[model samples]
Target: MSPTFTMSAGRPAPLGATFDGDGVNFAVFSEHARRMVVCLFSDDGKDEIARLDLPERDGDVWHGYISGLRPGQKYGLRAHGPYRPDEGHRFNPHKLLIDPYAKRLTGHPVWNDALMGYRADSSRADLTFDTRDSAPFMPRCVVEDPAFSWGEDIAPRTPAKDTIVYEAHVKGLTWTHPGVDAPGTFLGLASDAMLEHYTKLGITAVELLPAQAFLNDRFLVDRGLTNYWGYQTLGFFAPEPRYLDRGRIAEFQQMVARLHTAGIEVLMDVVYNHTGEGNEMGPTLAFRGLDNASYYRLMPDPRYYVNDTGTGNTVNVDHPMVLRMIMDSLRYWVEVMHVDGFRFDLCSTLGRVGEGGFDRGAAFFDAIRQDPVLTQVKLIAEPWDIGPGGYQLGAFPPPFMEWNDRFRDTVRRFWRNDPGTAPGLADRLTGSATQFDHSGRPATASVNLLTAHDGFTLQDVVSYDRKHNEANGEDGMDGHGENFSHNLGVEGPTDDVSILRARAQRKRNMMATLLLSQGTPMILAGDELGNTQKGNNNAYCQDNEISWIDWSQADDAFLDFTRRMIAFRKAHPILRQKLFLHSRERAIDGLEDLFWRRTDGQPMSSSDWEDPALSCLCVELRTASGTPLYGATETAIFAVFNAGEAERITLPEVPEGMRWVWEVDTTRPDALPGACCGATVQMPADAVAVFVTEVQP
Candidate 1:
């Protein structure tokens, strides 16, 4: 019995060192590199045992076979190529590179200038490259024999029309929960208590913020603030070690298993558009030190990076190897991590072509469309970036859902008492059919959201008119300037009872609008409990109590109201139709499929939308077939919204075999009024009411 496993050169078909029980196969994809060497490291990561040169080249892929290497063996890649930056080739032999297709990673990277292929203090910067090997500082990839017994776990495959997304942070979600102690980390996100909370919330899916292994910005770390949002991703294949338990992948798998068992889907917000390496002045972390020209989009002169993502360097998706890396990363998350979907950040960057125009048939899009496993899962796109022609919201092909920023902005303005917003609000309520109808995409193609992770919470929107980002240390300039929010008379905290009542009403109106809209709605984590960032719209840097979900601060009344509103949405079939109503000539009772009526029950004329003080309006929605479900005939629910001083509006004529029942009165407690008429539906100033007419025999 030999202490060391037998070692020999083997054939390379699959990239990265593949270790079968019999032998090990080595493969690396470096098109321009003259020679590639596989570096073996000991347990301590300080000593390098061997550097075997790979001499076989089949096409652009470099492959060689070695027998006797075990699965637990740690390794890295050292590619030999030219270090020319002007020609877009910044490959340095001195710096050890990670395999783009690595499966398992051991640890996290500790920032140091030694990790850079170029000297930090040198005035010449990347031009005057350093020759130090970075294997000591960087995390090495491990070759593990992939094996798992997924006894009965399966992707719930919740239909898009029925999906209710809850955008949450894996760490922030479970960290503060008193019951979820040991497993609040990434591995612990699927604890029984936490899963039960999500299941109870009635959310079909959880869209977690970026969980890809990331590093805190050096500047932010110097200021004692970390990138808590995890938007700065470094490793796509490996989960961040900070979220893991004892540097194991099993923790992540366990979380997925539990969530699946609980009938909830997981969607990862992936940031592949940019890397953590900030700018040209930033450290040479991975891509820059490995192959800067091939991995990133450099300017024509080659000194600066193409800042399309608004995050320093934009990835060069046009390159085959870079595109392959993204595809591999996505597959890893789906097959290994058991994620149900991915919400691509700045997805437009992934479809860019050489002509500087967005390409619908780009290799990346084509690959995902054709990939059997990926095509089956949900695909969501942020749909825009800061680059030229970046706002490609409706451009994604069928089967891909996009974050409808139009839906967000329009809803914000309308609820904030903005003038003449009825036209825009109508489009948003209809799932932005104008934008999505042409792509063979149903209404579900528009992921309607009023609030997301980047902006103000639902509570802050009704409380603050301007962003209060002074705590971010950026002197209030870090967040967005133009916030479409109304203070409801006084800004921030107020003791006035009227102001408190108005704030509560506004929150309900916003939530109800989102839930009742045609598309899939995503509620920001703490919004349901009236969470606030103290009016700070951007809390990316605030990892303290300011960003945490305060479970103790929940108002009992508001929580109960939220439960009722969510239940109302799930219970109603007309609110979530997959198809858009044709606008041509159909009107129920001479009213359109959806009609805007004034307080007097008269059809809202075009001029009525221009009324500034006109705070109240009613919307009547009906299904296309004049019936919502097979058993139930179509019933129009008139949602009366009173943004002005409360006034009791007379109820419309109750149809035959139907009596209106007070469903949800935003001003009152969770009480269902027994009598339909003569009930005097008291709508407090700045409140909304949902009066339902269930057909009676």
Candidate 2:
């Protein structure tokens, strides 16, 4: 420690440790804290060098300034308050806590009984507090110098209508790649191989699984498994240490800058609804030790936490300082980290209020909506939790796109030839009009996807009828019970050539449905390569080969198909529209903006939609109704979706000097353009054929 180091009262405006040229200022929020002490650690972050009590308190914030302290200093906080569990106050000064606003973490928490404030084996369970120094077991927080040279970096700002999201994990995407020098790290994600793949696949943004600092739960450690998905977030502003090469924050910045250079935006999957700390018996981490009742939503007993998120404890987002903390973290990512967007995990829990309630006008929603920085970036919501009224599909307000599970289930049942699915498929193919047409939201309000990280892969969806999760150590009981899957004929891996061919075509049909639909399309990272978890839908704890993308087993044909489909979607403006299509007529063109039909080429009757035996659907898409003259176009598109046997389809009539050009045929992936279509055509079984109108030059 510097002999000239001296402490004095500091400003409490900024809530984290800030480094100035001459010194560092530290501030933390703890409403019930009697005293807040900043402990300076040795250069190795092992031994304590200095301990100084904060000399100032403004409202709930305690602050102090240490002169001659450099930017490379390492420190941790200790809060002193009453340890009354029944009244929701659990503070132990012996347990070191990480700052809620920490932008850089030294490492993860080392698992130990001393880390917990309450004895795990105690019969009284949290009613009794233990006194043990935990600084040796906890990772120290560092004072970071947030300086970077982002030369000529710029966000792509891709519109929601044209955006295609690729959901990936930092480790899974590159850990098995042959070209990445630093596997399972942020530098690997920015490798030339990864950037080239994203560009080739027409991906506009990469939605990464949680990249924030997280804890590997003690229970998971005891089970010999790991939290591979990183949902147990510990530090919001800091990048996950495992993803960085040398524990420097610049690696994350380098990744963002390089992705921007390739015209790709970055989206983070964030979990703000819960924390790593479990219920009453959980460890005394940052929030629990600083001010328990103010940070978490406690139950009536004030000892147990509200488990609305299915995680142990729900964050008290309704509290003003807690809400401010979340908002500040979000803004930091946008302003400092330069991330393009966020996909909130279990977002419904963020809106929970008193007495089993959910409000659309909640303060969290209103705050983000009004913030200038947040409104500009993309915001996707998972839209559900385990709490009351938690299934809030189509419930979020404007500027937020939601994950639409209805699209996934409906499309799966439709392609599986399930009865009574035609109408539901029609509704989904047209952007789920019944669910998203209200509140002045656009068709892009629903993010349509056939598969995601939590469910079966695209290949597994057609290859496994039941979830095989015995490998998860849960006795086949952890994942979803009903996956809406089909095995075609045989289960798991099969040598039958007939079953293999059917599975391939089935995969194409579903991917085609997703690309041609009128909404944002998100592809699971390795689905294009036919990646499988051996039918384990819940591989959240498997960080081994089961979760990693095996590049050696790449399915070239499916990869080619994915690339072509994304290009096809980008080429057609009529498919990606901001307005929803009703059967209403356009005033200027005197034609219906959208039309549906059966295999007979005639307009579909109400009975056709209700027909259990109906095996196909046809649609003609045009510029949406009420589109201004500037938004209208001359091109029109026609498509056929056949899930059953071969059939003949009549074409929609074309205007004078106009011809329908054969654009796509899933059965013949090598099919070329400029093939003129006739009035009638023979469509293959279980295939999609798309045509675009061109001038008859």
Candidate 3:
């Protein structure tokens, strides 16, 4: 039996449940609540043991200290306030709410009618209140010890210029991984075999999809689907219990520590834009039950929510308490969880103030810029939303890398031989300087990616002309229509050798373009091994074989090509320069830093860039002297991409006593550096070739 203890008023400085050796102090913020109660539960989280009303009220914060409470104790909160949906005060003392700062959570929320704050079949909808108890269906927040022996765990802090981000879904990356001890879990993802794979792949960081505690939508559950991507966040500070092998939060810490030991940083895909509670008609599981008006941005009438995230509701980050909670959650992930950085999902919503627009000087951005810890970490933004003025691709401030969809489309169009795409491809190849060059930001600010989690894989990009989302259960109406993909004369997989060879070559061509571009490159996890989702561009609902990576089908040749490309990019610093490359000569040797050329070894004229039918181009990079860049001296690289038919192309002029060596040729089976080539090279149709200049010492 647990020991009985007296309850005392606790300080409200540090919010959430804080355990300090002897006892536990619980503090929660609810500005409109008339009363607050902390409900303590048993270890199994099924039985409620005690319920104590907070004795102290420091302004809008309710706080209390319990002397006998230990670290393993499970608890939840219930606030008493008006149940007026029209007024935006959705407080119900009967419903158990999750702590916004919960470090750990136990049990999965069981779907039931009691979980809903309002009646399901009632015509009055949110205006009508349900009095049934929701504690049985809700997950309990656990008071974590927060004590872990992280001996000598150091962050890799890989420089943005040299960083290669591998965006992966924790479960999807390892669910079908052969010979793993615990597949589809944090421990499985941090296994030695996985770490070795990442090391050999030459990626500096793993950008994981959302690992925060999240909810499986009832609609998805009813439709026999699951929220595999985990965008519907429930608790920010807590790791998703489903991903834990033993349901212990320490497993997450161990995963981070192990990844750090392997010299690979961990970047979480966080969703601070909105919560899983959703609109007024949605369930009041946590935030909506605690304080709806303060946590969510409501309409002028306060009945409906502002759906800026296209998810049903938007987080009111303009609110002081809500903003503080977000900041605290970010710090917890960095300080306690030891994550190196974050990639904000639907980030535009976080930078929007009340009634105005997405402002760069919003409180959320200002707070992050001024933060002592967050400012030092790598910050990446999705930089768009469904709200008004949402497509702010290159509008993010310094230290933030925005995902460049323009690069994805341009590269795709260029390889597909689309007309009038040469100029756009040129801009993307040099790092989209027109977009990210301002505000003292370098080329690294443009996170150039060909395909991300929401799109088709590299293999599918070359194999499927349209999205095949029939398995998603939405009558194939979902997913993007204009994927900028080409089927190469076949819709799906085929045994025809010609089509197969063409698709493979196209895949290699795009991969080469992505890796050789002058910006921070992000590779989709299974793209290196030629993983395909059978044309399901939006596999957010297909959690089966369509989403899980199949290690059995790993393509060795494609993997080798990817590995070599990454190694080549790292070896040649000219490809990953911090500053944008210009066409002027900065070296004493009179070699230009960067320049575009035609197939005939002549500099590209203004008319060439403007030509609508132009389907071929060459980019040359050489050593410069203006300010010493990252690479060695006396180095030069020439890359030729041909989207047209096979033709004889004259190689560009090399420096004083240098000869061009074929480094990578997409048309060839192997991309290894071969013998020196002559002045003119035979370029294959729909392929890319790379040559490096070596001086005769």
Tens-digit lDDT track for model 2 on 1-697? 5345578998897889998887899989999999998989988998988888999999999999997788768899999999999999998999999998888889889889888898777898688778889898898888998888988899999999999999999999999999887989999999999999999999999999999999988877888888899999989888998999988999999999999999999999999999998888788878899999899999999988999988889999989999999999999999899999999999888877765677888889999999999999999999999998899999988888999999999999989998888788888888998888899898999999999999899989999999998877888879899999999998899999999999988899899999999989899999999998888899899989889999999999999998999998988878888888767675656677788987777898877777898878899887654232232334678889888899989999988887888888888887776588899888999998898887787
Lowest-sum lDDT 10-residue window in model 3 = 625-634
- Give me the displacement of residue 642 in model 2, in angstroms: 1.3
Q: Estimate each model's TM-score.
A: 0.93, 0.97, 0.97
Show the colliding residue pairs in model 2. none
lDDT, candidate 3, 605-673, per-residue tens: 999888999998888886566333443333778888889998788887766677888888998857457
Q: Candidate 2: TM-score?
A: 0.97
Model 1 collision count = 4
Put the candidates in lDDT order, highest first: 2, 3, 1
TM-score of 1: 0.93
565 Cα displacement, candidate 1 (Å): 1.4
lDDT of each: 0.78, 0.89, 0.89
